[model samples]
Target chain A: MNDSQQNIKKNVLEKIRHGDVVMRPKIYFTLQVIVVAVVAVCAFIASVLVVSFAFFSLHESGELLLLGFGVRGLLTFIALFPWVTLLIAVGLVVLLEWLIRYFKFSYRQPILKVFFVAVCVVCVGGLLITFTPLHTNLSDTADRGDLPFIGQLYEDVHMPHEDKGEFRGVVVSVATSTITITHNDHDADADDGTRVVTVPTNFNTSILHIGDRVYVAGDMTNGTVTAYGLSKF
Target chain B: MSDSHPPYPTDEELVTRVQHGDQEIFGELMDRYTEKLSRYGRQFLARPEHIEDLVQDVFIKAYQNIQSVDTSRKFSSWIYRIAHNAFVNALRAQQTAPISYFDFDTFTAHPVYEDGHAERKEAEEMRVLVEKGIKKLDQKYREVVMLYYFENMDYQQIADILHVPIGTVGIRLSRAKALLKKELPVDTTHI
Candidate 1:
């Protein structure tokens, strides 16, 4: 190396060594590791808590019950606790790393590597947990109801009450909570004119509106058999 | 290799020792990396006044956070990573709250030349021109080039430091060199 290059290297080495001594303070590394670990734990706990709270809130609002009483059914399918915790821990670590990057914090080199590996291990643990039969079963139950053909029947049944006599009509006024069906036959009496029925609050009542031709099937009790299902003719 | 200084411990060994509470070893690490890191910091930030302060900040952070570092990985990369982060943060701070009194021209003035020979002057001018060319390049290209040439890091090492793919490092280096060659009167092709 040239004299200048050699000088530069020497200067760098000397400065680094000198500065290393001056800058290196005792207990800093331990403190840093503790800080990182604490931050990771806090973030994971916060995220899981927030998610659980939102889920329970939705359930209490009757949304989940209306959507289908699958919450209890799916609970049996959850992955083992150890696997879930491991996955959450891994997710939290990754999140912590991203946060560290965002804030531009530096940890000791050895500690950083260990933190990274711990995160990866947690991620693998989570993936393994998610793939377990219990987890898969829970997911399937949530997406599709547990009872073999009951879900389809629940989805297909839309008429007010199924026991009423056959009545062909087109939907007229539809309100926030009710559907008014008007029969096509002009000779139909005013008392038998437009059939107003109460629809379940949970039903996707958004799809039904005025002017939809529908075939209704139910018994005619007091001139109104509650229609069980309505088919678009 | 024949220097009077004791041989520097490998980063892993230093980390293991540090984890065991051997605080002295950390000082050795600081001594090992500070100068090269300062130069790297200098390349990202133009203000020579802030370079030492910036480098000092990086070392302090490294020393303080030493326990968190994974012992298995190369200590050098981790230290460089810290330095790079420090440099970027300093640059960001400068952008958000700029120092109005700072003058680039004042910082660029050459240290007084003791030898006034024509050959020495020309060589000095060449070195200045090279530095000027580097300063003119975009930050992305400038960073890779500085780490590769001034820091004496290979493409893979530069990639790791910059958090880019090896191919990206190669591309940036080639572009930076081409840009520098165009800007400098000196024949960088031969260099």
Candidate 2:
């Protein structure tokens, strides 16, 4: 070998023999990549969940329950649907893609390819998550006064409660202290319509009958409606 | 007399041997890449200062971090990627250029249109023309040019080294070739 070549080899060998650095095991980098991939997947799954809620809200329309909203209602529903949940879902997935840039392979990939793949994965996962029993459990917990803040959010999307203290429900039972009412599912406001209301200690309770459809104006605390005024629908 | 070795072992085989407690074999690998990688670094840096130090640093780093690589991959790509990063980081530290400022969002290069299959010329002339053309390109395109022409790597290999899609490798090469054709013109016979 030439002098310069010999010199390079000598210098390289010197560095290696110094013992100042250790070669990390290949498995550790592999594990790190695996961990990053798992985190990305988790972000994707969470994004799907947010999208599922948006799907459930769209399901709020009574017509969609039967799988036919007709053209006009469908158009209006699309126009008026609060898109925050879906928007947040999309934002979340995009953020996950941004996170993917940390990976050597992902950062080098075309943005379109990554984005398309991410959206597809999220949509498929989101649809499956939306159909799962998770939403049901959340709704149940929300009605039970367990979750903070967003608990009432679930109740509002799935049930019709008037902004002006009005609640519509079918009277399930009659009692002197409290009358039980299942929320009116057919009302335009309550899509799935499953919130239960206990109307308590109102003077108009004497007029309420079993199975009577009624509208009560009241404060809902822990999913119970306390009526200041009551009327028969 | 017939030789027991298969002329030269493939890079993958060499790596397997290295992983099997064969530290000495790594020097052989370094000898193979030293000249080529040094040229790549020189072209990238566009200056002739501490290039030997840069090349030596790549060897040292690659050796120290050898175990971190997924051995299933082509060793050359992994090492080249390390070299590429080292070069880019060194250049970026000088504060001249950020890596990716080109808006590739709208740029889609047509492979067939940019293919230079008809660009027939002598190897020496082609080499000179190519070197000049590559120097004129932005780094994004330059790396692809070097890998394709100087290193004689396939599109897939280039993709692996650069961490881009296989199609992206083709596209970048195509765009680089188009840029070259603009910088220097030539005539060729198509059969």
Candidate 3:
């Protein structure tokens, strides 16, 4: 070996022999792997739950039906979109990606590929979870005031957005050109929860029935809603 | 013509022994990797005087972190990874090139592929050009060239050491060659 090579080898071995440098215990690395794995799993679960809840909220709020109501409905859907939930989901996915990047399988692929794969997996998992009763049970818990901190998310889901010219309730009475609806079962006792909706001349009430859940888009002046768009969910 | 000595232990075997508390065996690893890492450091740091200290630091880190090495994988990759980090940190301290926080090359997919025969031929032809124009290339491109042509590492090994995608290694090498062509004296396109 050359003089320089000998010097490097001797200096390093001397450091090791003299205890200036020492190998970390096996448990240290083991714990590091375990912690990364746990955090990754936690972030993934949080991402899936947050994404699924966002979709569920949009559907239960009758906002999903707004997409079919034309431009105004589309605008309301965008305005009421759960941006916070979406941001949280994105953050969780990024955290998950950062955690998994240290692994061989993930590092072998392009970051975009890994990020795309993670997003797809989380979105699919979220959609699949929507089919389950998880959110339904959670919503019910929130309604009862038993849920901590997140109860507000489910509180106003069934309420009408008067400011946005959007209303959701159950049809209580139907006439030739008008329909009377009451706030969803949650506020049945509130005397002011009912409204009279005036439909267009060509509007069809043949598809309408009492007690059907419906969405109405119109201007509400006083206790009556001048309806321009209406649909039954 | 009988062989007098038994076959030497592989780097993986030696590392496994080191992990199992064979501290002295690290000296053997140091002896094996010092020259190789010095060459890597010299090419990467652009300062031959600093290579010995940098190589020594790499050995110290490798020895201290011996328990973290996975015996199933290549020990060369692990050591080279340490060396790469050390050299990059030194270069960063020197502010030689702007290595951004995010590398877009790794952020997206590239269409480049590694063909063994073609890569060997291209590397041979580009070696002289790379030696002449390497200092002008960016840090990100220069390191891949050093690892590929100078260290003789394959795309996957370079990816492991650099913690980048294999396709990234290919893209960087291709881009490095393009840059070298522009910076070199001859018309490299004919090669």
Ranking by TM-score: 3, 2, 1
Give the Cα lDDT of each candidate: 0.54, 0.69, 0.86
What are the root-mean-square deviations of the candidates from the true structure over C-alphas? Answer: 16.1, 8.6, 2.4
- Candidate 3 lDDT tens digits, A1-233: 79978998888888889999988888889999999999999999999999998888888887788788778778877887889889999999999999999899999899989999999999999999999999888888876778888877777666678788888788999998999988753532353478899975588987789999888888899879988788887
Question: lDDT per residue, candidate 1, B1-191, as tens digits?
Answer: 57999886687888788767766565566656766876787778867567766666676667656666777766777789888888877877767565343223122212222232542335444445447687898767777767655665665566567554455565566566567768776554344
What would the DockQ be for model 1?
0.05
Question: Which numbered prediction scores highest in lDDT against the true structure?
Answer: 3
Model 3 spans with C-alpha error above 4 angstroms: A1-5, A185-192, B46-49, B96-98, B187-191
Task: Give the CA lDDT, 0 to 100, for residue B185 in model 1.
Answer: 62
The full ranking of all candidates by DockQ, starting with the best, is 3, 2, 1
- Which candidate, 2 or 3, has the higher TM-score? 3
lDDT of 2 at A180: 78
True contacts kept of each: 0.06, 0.45, 0.90
Lowest-sum lDDT 10-residue window in model 2 chain A: A61-70
Comparison by lDDT, 2 against 3, better one: 3
lDDT (Cα, tens digit) per residue for candidate 1, span A1-233: 33443443454445646654333444665566578667866775554443333233232222222223243323321311124434554566667655554222322122345465645554455444434454334333433556364333222222222232334457887777657787533222232356765543364657876787655443455645354444454
Higher-ranked by lDDT: 1 or 2: 2
The true-versus-predicted C-alpha distance at residue A183 of model 1, in Å, is 15
